[model samples]
Target chain A: MRKKRMINKFTLYISLVILTFIFLFPLVWMLVSSLKNEFQIFRDMQSLQAFLPPAPADVEGGYFHNYVAAFQRVDLLRYIVNSLIYTIGIIIFGLIVNSMAGYALARFRFPLAGFWLGVIIATLIIPPESIFLPLYVLVYDLGWVNTYTGLIVPFIANAFAIFLFRQFFLDFPKELEEAAKIDGCSQIGIFFRIIVPLSKPVFATVAIVLFINHWNDFLWPLVVASDESMRTIQIGLQYFMNEPPIKWGQVMAALTVATIPMLLIFAFLQRYYVQGLTHTGSKN
Target chain B: MKGNDSSAEKLENERHFHQTAKKPQLKPTPPPRKKRKLKSQAFREAMTGYFFLAPALVLLGVFLLYPMGAAFYYSFTDFYILTPDDVSFIGLENFKYIVEDAQFRQAFWNTVYFSVIVVPVQLSVALGLALLINKKLRFRVFFRTAFFSPVVMSLVVVSILWTFMYNPNEGLINQLLQTVGIPPQPFLTSPDQAMNSIIVMSVWQGAGFQMMIFLAGLQNIPNHLYEAADIDGASSWQKFWHITLPGLRNIALFIFITISIAAFKLLVQPMIMTQGGPLGTTKSLVYHIYETGFNYRDVGYASAMAVVFTVIVLVITIIQRVLIKEERG
Candidate 1:
């Protein structure tokens, strides 16, 4: 029995290690390929050498040139700045607005609160694509085309965020607010000082989710930002490969740089990501 | 004389009793005012809710809802970029064209086929991985992050990376296959393999999310059921097949439907990797809508297609919900 158990454990470990490799392979390959020279990357597709391959004497200087060319061609710095401005703008506004709405739905005993919650949750089912056409017309009519407002306005209040916040606030101990009221604190005062401060995990979760969505959003930005000057990194990178003579090296370099910020952000805030997801999953 | 004084005191007491009766009247007045104040307070709370929701509502209405309505109206019109004044009602014609158009039909079928093949494969792999990591394994967090990292990377980045990875000449995939003496296969290059290649990349990127969902589901299952199974000498397979499978049913259904819907909207990979080509084999309905609206500037026809696509998605969602709800019932 002991020997049999040992074999089962060994099999489980072996299978797990193999599966881990399979899952991690592409990301690993991409990272290594990002460091290798064009020729080396193309030469040994299977070999581990393809990633960070040893360079011949002549190829020593090409790597920096690739990155520089990538930055120059697309104005990557501007794209990053554009992404940051848009993402940060949405997150700050989205968090405050969503939390306020959520708090009301959870705490207040207003007529039609349940109805309003239902309506908002129903919107979650209507895929955003279904509404894209009307939104474009509205933006055009308002002369918001090619503007920051056009990109940011429609997404400022997310249903998921509101729903998540409301759920979180529902379980929030009433004693905290009651104590504040006894101390002669107003509702708004207690909210700002007490409620918001206590909800750090959910706040972090919302920030990560909102920032990632806005940062990676390609379709909306594609429609809104027609000018090269306003183009986001996602859409900006596409211009490189859209031309007849595609520059693979430069495209890879640009993609590498664009993806780094997201990876770093997600890596740091992953615990929050899982936390928010758990809240949603469990509620449902 | 004393009896006369007692009578005077009684008369004074009667007068005081009359004033005491008036005190009850004041209580009724305060009740109405208190009710009015509560009503006003409720109204104020409602207004605050609206204020909080206003920003999101305006944008959602303008960009999302307006576009949806326009797509419906424009679908029936003969809209052209060149002559805005020449627009005319062409009811059912656009729909007729979609039904008759070979490429449109092919794209529609391809999307359906892709969804059918990809959703299950992706979700199953995700569940498998989730189960694996749900065990108390070493480096579980590292493994989880590694699996999900690709999901954070943009489609443009993943496509570019995978395009190289799928390169028939020097791609890692082909090199691995060559080691097993299997001839190098054209992945994205071949029309036959292009969609499959896209699916592989998509599944790799997407499975991590479903895996996370499955992990949550797995944790929710009661360990006592497995413990009971062990007492009965039930094999691991039996426990998984009976308890684990039944426990994960709702999550599996949810993931399946979500993945199906997401896969149906396949646009980015084909656009970036193949440009819907190696012969129009990779063009999806959403991409077609984009091409028509942007490339050709045939807003009217594109709107028609968009409306059709939206209806199809809605129908699918409803069907999925109904089916799953029935099963649960």
Candidate 2:
């Protein structure tokens, strides 16, 4: 019985390790193949001796050339800058607008407040894809195509952010604001001075969430930006991959470059990301 | 002297009446004036509240509501992007063609199958992982982070990486299978295996999120419940069934709904990896909608698909909500 139990534990560990490999395999392979030459990468499986550094001639000037090539081909630096601008723009706008709306919903008593909250919540159920067509038409009508303003403006005030901020603000202490109000400060002054400062944790959570969404986003950028100059990193990568006779090596190199900022951001802001997920669904 | 006394009493009564008439009837004079100031301040605060909400309201109206209305309108007509003047009433012809189209039917079933297969599998695995790591295991944090890191990785990156892994000749998946004495699988190349391959990659990347949700649910389940079960001499199976499962019902419902919706939106994976091929087995409703609208320039047909797809998703969500409500009720 003891031997059987030991066997079971060993099997469990092995299975888990294999599952992890399966999860991490693609990324690891991409990284490895990026360092290899075209022949080494495209060579049949049996011809390869093992996973090792490719021959010196095969690597030649190495992965750096591919990276440079990718950058030059798509003007990757501009894509990166465009992506940052669009993403940061949306997050800033979303934070201010959503926080204000959330603060109002949470603190104030007004006519039709509950009704409006319900409407906002209902919009969350309607997927954005459902309205992509008309939104495209709207963008075209405004002649906002290929503009950063168009890219960021449509998504600046998301219902999800409002919901998240409202949820966060619900548990905030009412007395602090009341005391501030009594101290000869106006409502706006109190909100700016006390409420905003106190809500840093939630504000960070919203910012991180918005930043991640905009950073990794592909579909909207694919649609809105027509000019190569206005192309975000995701759109640039997509165009590169499908431009013709797919360039896997260069694409991987480019993707690795494009993905690094998001990865670094995720690593840095993971605490907030995990916290937001954990706290969002919990009521008490 | 008696007449003088009576006149003095009448004068005292007259003085009392004058004082009472001079004072405010509703409130004491000092407090009534203060009350007016407080009321006006409250009104001002309410007005400022509306001012704060106005921008978000306007944006939501322009981006969400107006676009949704336009989508519905366009679904009824022949909406064209090139020539705005040429939109004509097509009635339900766009929607009707959806049923008659073979590709739409295939895409619909593909999406349904994806959800059907992925939802339960992902949920079960997530629950298992949550349970495994819920114990006091060494390196638990490392394992948790490693598993969850992919959740934040761009799906585009994940898709591209998996395409390399699904390469028939040198891919790690088949290579590993061969080492195990199993013949190589088609993986992504064969139509039969393409959707399944996508499912595997998706599950691997996504299960960690639900695992974390399950972990949160597990943590929230009080330890005293388990202690009580131990005292009652309940078996582990019984404890899990009566305690853990019931405790996680709401969370499980949430995961189910989210995973189901996400499964239907399986465009990025197929788009990057397969381009909906080896005969379009992995083609999903959303991908089809995208291609029809943008690639084929059939905006009317795409809108119809989008409308139908939206209705299906809404119906499924509503059904889940109703079922959950009923269960709770």
Candidate 3:
């Protein structure tokens, strides 16, 4: 029995190792192939060499010419900047607007409060894709197409963000806010001074969530912001990939650049992301 | 008189008044002329509440509510984007037209086929993974990280990467298959295999997320239950079936609904990789809707498809909610 258990454990380990390889080799290949020129990449493709960096002596530009080529070939840097602008704009505006609305629903007894909360929660069931057509039409009618305003402003007030913030703020200690009020802090002052500071984790959670969301956003930008200046990295990469003479090296390099920040975030902030994953459905 | 009320009385009132919710903070009143000041302050707070909600309400109104309303309203009429003024109130025609539309039906069936295959397989992989890693094992952390690394990639990147990998001629997948003595397969080139290829990549990308959730759920199952099962001479499979599966019932329901809803919106993969090609076998509902609305400028038909898609989502979600509500009892 003990000998059988040993065999089982060994098999288990081997199987898991193979699975890990299957799961991760694409990423490994993406990074490795980025370092190799097209000729060396295809030449090394069949064997385990595909997952290794090319020797420094073989390549003319050494390792990272693809990174330079990615930028020079297409407007990749501009797309990255545009992505950051739109994503950050949404997060900043999203956190304030959604959180304040959430706080009101959670902590204040305004007229029609229940009605408003109901409306917001109802919207949560409706994914943005379901309504993108009319939204594009609306944006077009507003003459805001291809503008940052069109990209940022429409996505600022996310229903799910509002719902999450409301849930978080409800659990906040009412006594602390009550004491702040007794000390002559106005309602807004209490929110800014006390509630805001105390709610940092929830704020960070929502911000990260929003960042992951808008950064990966593809369809909306494809429809509304087709202009080269307004293109997000996803759209730019899509166009870049499609514009004939596809270079796998530069493509991998560009994807690596696009994906590295998220990997770094997962390394550091996996706890919060996992928590969000469990509590909420995987939005992606 | 109010000042004379005990602190317990105040707590009691706060608790009782808001039975299912938390009460808003009511400011402490001074000894004299408290009621009028309290009333005025209450009004001021309510007004401030409205002020706080103003920006979100405006955006949600113009962008979310108005667009949804327009989409619903336009679904009934022959609302072409090019000839916007020529729209007429043609009741149920768009819906009727879809009944006769073969391409729409194909897209719908393709979406269903994706969800049907991807959901169960991904969920099983996730659960199986969670079971493996939940135990104390060497290199488990590395294993978890490896599995989840793909979730960090955007769908666009993954699609492009897989398109490269799925290339039948010189791609690595076929090369690996050949060494195992298997014949090379046309993955993305064939219509029948294209959706399945996309499905495989999707499961690889998505199973990691569900695995994390399942790991969480596995940890939540009390240790004593398994210990009791062991003491009762139950086999590992028996313990898993009786304790583990039942323990994860609610989470499974949740996962089922989320996966199915997301699967129904399958547009990105077909868009990037196959362009919904090889005789439109890979054409998803959203892809078709997008093409019809934007490419062909057929707004009314796309709107009808969107409405149908939204209703399917809402129905699935509502079913989950009802099931969860039943589970709570």
Candidate 4:
């Protein structure tokens, strides 16, 4: 029995290690291959050396050349700044708008409250893809195409974020609100003072999700932001891919640069991100 | 003395009559005033609620609901972006064209095929990974993180990276296959292989997200059920079949529906990697709509397709909701 159990444990570990390798290899390859010269990448394709960085080359600037080349070819810094502006704009505005709406639905007694909540929830069923055409037309009519307003404003009021905030506020203790009310705090004041502070977890969760979402948004920005200077990182990468004679090293470097921030954010907030997503999945 | 008494009695009687008349009128009047105050307070509260909700409601109306309505309307009209003034109603013409368009038909089937193939494959792999990590293990968090890392990466980046990996000659996948003595396959180049390649990459990139949900589901299953099964001398497979599967049913269903919906909206992969390629084998509906609406400048036609697509999604979701509700009942 003891020997059998030991074998089972050994098998489990082996399988896990293999699974881990399978999952991590592509990312690892992308990162490491970014550090190789074009020739080295092609040369090391067949062996374990593909995972290793290049040795010092005499002619090229060696490992960092691809990074420099990628930066030169695309205004990567501009794209990064665009992504940040859109992401931060969405997060800040989304939290305020969605949370306020959520608070009203959760706390206040009002006619048609149920009806309004239902309408908001119903919008969740409408996939954004189906309406992309008209949405683009609307933004164009507003003359918002290729502007920050086009990129950020439409997405700031997410129904999912509102639903999350509403769910959180429903579980919030009413006594705190009662105390604030007795002290002459207005409805909005209580929300700003008491509810928002106590709901930091939900705020973080919503912000992280929204930040990742806006940062990674491709389709909407692809339609709305046609100008080269206004492109986000994802769109920038897509444009990079379209260029002919695709330099594999620089492409890999650009991809690595684009992906690093997300990985770092995920590393730090893995728990909250996982929890938030799972919470959403289960609620649905 | 007799005249004085008569006058005093008459004065007292008149005063009493005036007091009785005033009391009934005052009772009814005060209640109305109090009721008005209460009504106004309620109205004020409702106004505050509306004020708080205005920003989200207006945005949703403009961006989501109004666009949906506009898309429906645009489907009936020839609303080209370039010529804004020449718009005219053309009832059902775009839908008729969509039906007759071979590419649209191909895209519809391609989308269905991709969704049908990818959802189950992704879910099963996620469930398997969830079960694997659910066991007591060393460095479990590390393993979970490793599996889930791809979910954080942008779809565009994933598509680009996979495009490189799908390179027939020097790609890591083919290279690895060659190490095991399998002949190299043209993954993205071949018509037969391109869609499958995208599906494979998609599953790899997407499974981690569902796995985390499954992992959460797995953790929520009480351990005592397994303990009871062990006391009954149940085999490992039996334990999983009896306890784990049933415990995860709702989550599994949720993941299934969501993955199916997401799979149906496939665009970025084909857009970036295949560009609907080799012979339009991987061209999804959304990709087709994008091509029609933007590339071909056929907004009405694309709007028609979008309406049809939205109806299909709505029907599928309603069916799922009904099924879930029935199961719960």
- Return the top candidate by TM-score: 4
Model 4 misplaced regions, further than 4 Å: A55-63, B1-29, B32-34
Off by over 4 Å in 3: A281-284, B1-35
DockQ of 2: 0.49
Q: What is the lDDT of residue B128 in candidate 1?
A: 84
Candidate 1, position A242, lDDT: 74
DockQ of each: 0.50, 0.49, 0.53, 0.74
Best-to-worst ranking by lDDT? 4, 3, 2, 1
Model 1 compared with the native: what TM-score? 0.89
> Which candidate's DockQ is highest?
4
Pairs of residues at least 3 apart in sequence or in different chains that clash in candidate 2 = none
Candidate 3, residue A198: CA error in Å?
A: 1.4
What is the lDDT of every predicted structure here? 0.80, 0.82, 0.89, 0.90
The residue-by-residue lDDT of candidate 4 on B101-207, one tens digit each, is: 99999999999999999999999999999989987788999999889978878899999999988889888888989999999999999999999999999999999
Instruction: Write model 4 residue lDDT over A29-88, tens digit each, in one string.
Output: 899888887788887888888877666653367567889999998899999999899899
Candidate 2 all-Cα RMSD:
8.1
Which has the higher TM-score value, candidate number 3 or candidate number 4?
4
The segments of candidate 2 whose C-alpha lies over 4 angstroms from its true place after superposition are: A1-8, A39-65, A243-248, B1-39, B181-184
lDDT of 2 by residue, B1-329 (tens): 99999999999999999878876664654657788998987888679878878889899999998988888888888876776789998999998898899999999999999999999999898888788778766667767776776776688878876776677876656676676788888788898899999998899889988899889989999999999999999999999999999999888888888899988887889888888897979999999998987887667778888889889889879988997898789
> In model 1, which runs have C-alpha deviations exceeding 4 angstroms?
A1-3, A52-59, A62-65, A182-184, A242-248, B1-31, B81-87
Number of backbone-clashing residue pairs for each candidate, in the order shown: 8, 0, 0, 0
